[model samples]
Target: MNAVVHFLILLVVLSAAAFILFLLRAPFWLILLVIVAVYMAVTTVPTFHTVYKSQNLRAIDRFLLRNYRKPIFNYAYNIGHGTDEEIRNSLRTIIDKSSRGDARHVYSALLGVHSGDGDEVLAHAGKINPGPLRSYYYAYGTALNGDLDEAGRIAGKITDEWMKHTIYAVIAKKQGNPEEFRKEAKYAEDASVGIQHYLLHHNFRKMAESFNLSQEGSSMMQLVENTAVELKDGRRGLILGVRDNEEIVQYDVELGDGEIITVFAEEVRRPV
Candidate 1:
């Protein structure tokens, strides 16, 4: 489509320039030179803009890494880009060296959940101040320790909707109820927004895959490659691609304004 547009644009420009030159009785060589110049300018401008945008994004990433300097930032980067062994090493180093805080507890709990080490999970769960968050960690730890019923009971007490639904989904997964897991997981996914959603999808995706949820081509998702869809917020976008992580499906949507954002399947709907 872009190629066709560019071709039509070039043809129109060249035709216009040739007509003007003919009216002025200019030489053929001069008309050809002007057409070549116009074509080069039109095509190269988009290339330049694309290259500048790519470089700008990279620069922003470098600036964040330099100034943010948080252990969690590094952990997020490693989770996205590193191998399983690298992620384990990064988590362990963060646990060993980072000062005790909620981030540390979260790091510990995720590693524990991945490793199925109830003791590791409980160790951090106890340090977290009593609240919905702490209850979630405890419930997850209990679930890891082979008490799905008790875990479900504990998770049920969490008041925060997203956290509550997420814990329940995990418990359902542990209990081997795929239907319950999918239902609760969708609730959690729907309640999440922005970066919190990103973190959940990335960190919990492997565990989600254990349920063998849905495929990229599943019509149940109602998503097709490059199709237009409406966001939950009523914005329209084109689906650039699908990130099909079994139980978790995210779409890279290019909005009408040309800003690309990642959103979970539940965050989008068929265009109205």
Candidate 2:
């Protein structure tokens, strides 16, 4: 796969060989082997750190975004993409069922089409009660439809700066201003909006670097990755209007393209 993975695998092999040699009571060679093994381990620390950062902080997540996001589409693709009616119908069906995984892609699919599909996605969101997904839908939905009133209203209620900036960038995209998008994307330390905006100009490598990753940064990594996919899928970001009601009270997430999604537990309505 990647260079970092290759390095780790190599480390494993060396360690294993050194262990076996020690077990065999081998004399001079075993000592030499162990020394080499120790040397390799010690020398590779910085590389490991760098690679770890690159993996969790940047690469894998961006790679996911590059390949799997389905919401947004290339600007030119909007012209002759799916028909308005088809897009509308699909948006309705998907949003009505809105599990965590499918949510982002549904948004992605909406962005991929002409603005008509974006309208339909919001319409579907309107039918839901306030909760986590609905929270996201409200903001994300408004951005897609060029409904600045609703978008701003929803964003005003969100406390998370990352979500706010992400939505701001989306609004900028709909309004046709890359500069504004870049400004919003950079609002968060974890979110490399600066890099995302650059990549929007089509520099994927730089985007990956901005998304640097590590074990502890997996969540941020996934966010970058999901954001990347949104870019790839023709969707930029999502807007959710959250309310704490009987139906929903926690955050829910969906992986890009509907493959691996996670959301909070669904509210169970009991008969009175």
Candidate 3:
């Protein structure tokens, strides 16, 4: 838009230049203005549409960047495992262009959602994690047996490579920093766990026995309490999966004759 506006201004300036020349009966100046104006009009229209398309793409990219791929990594992990599904698959298909996470190439996936609607996108965010990673915050990692003094010390001095966020929040409180504790807690919470994330955290993890090949993803998400294998029907979890690259394995989270609660992502269309 800014470029288009500047181009129009340039045309007006050329016109004035031509008008001044014509006042002195100078030749070629008037024709110069006309050519500039015609070029500007033709160029601006298509550029405007291009800009409009870009804006739509940014809306989707903002949340999926390095600043936010943990969730998406979680999403992909889910889809690859049991929680992974058709909806998640469709979302990844939009890549106005995917530059392997480059900034300028973000529009590559702007139409990832097919339409510009915040509510729907947010809804997807919620379904992915429900309410942050609160459930994953267990006492064992903070301190054993809920012993405050020991727990406080461990939490205060935590520096684990894997669960840094969760451990740091504990340490922050021991240092008597409420602000630090809150901030770190949220980070730890949001970064809690996703099954697929752990599975594919590295190409090596996929080859290791720790990551089950049967689940088809990074099993690290299992470290956090709630992820791919969620409890269902007051009995067991409804683990999901893909069969021979063609079928969706489902779980019955809630089960009874007439009532059932199933948790899985649905596919959304990509925009043309």
Candidate 4:
């Protein structure tokens, strides 16, 4: 609807300018320049202004470079993995400067939840807006603080399938029900895609290991670090990292020729 309105307005403005120029007998080149300038003013300038006022790091980064993907989430993940001080400081700086409604805090809170730090998760939760993402972290923090019932209650109201089932899985794990955890985790994994799926799978794998349960039914196999696997092209490789997103899962695998390639999950398999 807004696009239609904008297009109508542009059309009217251009028509008026053209009429006035025709009446004034303006040069063809001069009229064309004015129209081009008006078009930029009506389109590009407002886009730049909106991005500038929002102060969204991702938006600003994309404005400068169309293909840039923010590494802020990776930095937060590193924080939970016991990264160096410099990396932690960099993440802190990014979080501090990011817009209040930005989702970076949630990523950090997820890491806190992964580490079982209720305090850290709560702190990050407070920084987020009142929404499903904030509620998700709040429930995780509550669970970590030993209130499984309340956490489950909070999670039950969440509408996002991924968030709801993932939290249920966490609550089930806390309740020492390995079967429930496995069931809920399968649902969660099925509903998730992209980076959310990757992160959730990683956390779920770690939680599953804690229960001494083999991942039997999940599509995302629990591939450990530094493991050997076979590529689909009849070659061998070592798992370097699991770091792809979207409908297809991918892994960073180093081939026998010492070349690292990000191959799809179906293109790799466990050694026979």
Cα-based lDDT for every prediction:
0.67, 0.45, 0.36, 0.67
Over 4 Å off in model 1, which ranges? 1-70, 215-272
Top-TM-score structure, candidate number: 1
Deviating ranges (above 4 Å) for candidate 4 = 1-70, 73-101, 217-272
Span of 10 residues, lowest total lDDT, candidate 3: 58-67
For 16-66, candidate 2 gives per-residue lDDT tens digits of 777777788779766786768667775676444533333233332333333
RMSD of each: 16.0, 19.2, 20.1, 12.6
Error of 4 at 55 (Å): 32
Report the error of model 1 at residue 177, Å: 1.7
lDDT tens digits by residue: candidate 3, 99-200? 454321222122222233323433333323322221112222233223445544534443442345544554554465556655655564345333312322
Off by over 4 Å in 2: 1-14, 17-58, 61-116, 126-133, 173-179, 188-272
* Model 1 C-alpha lDDT versus the unseen true structure: 0.67
Q: Write the per-residue lDDT of candidate 1 for residues 121-229, one digit (tens) a residue.
A: 8898888878877888898889889888888899788887778888788888778888887778777756765434434544455555677666222222248654557
TM-score for each prediction? 0.52, 0.38, 0.19, 0.51
C-alpha lDDT of residue 251 in model 1? 91
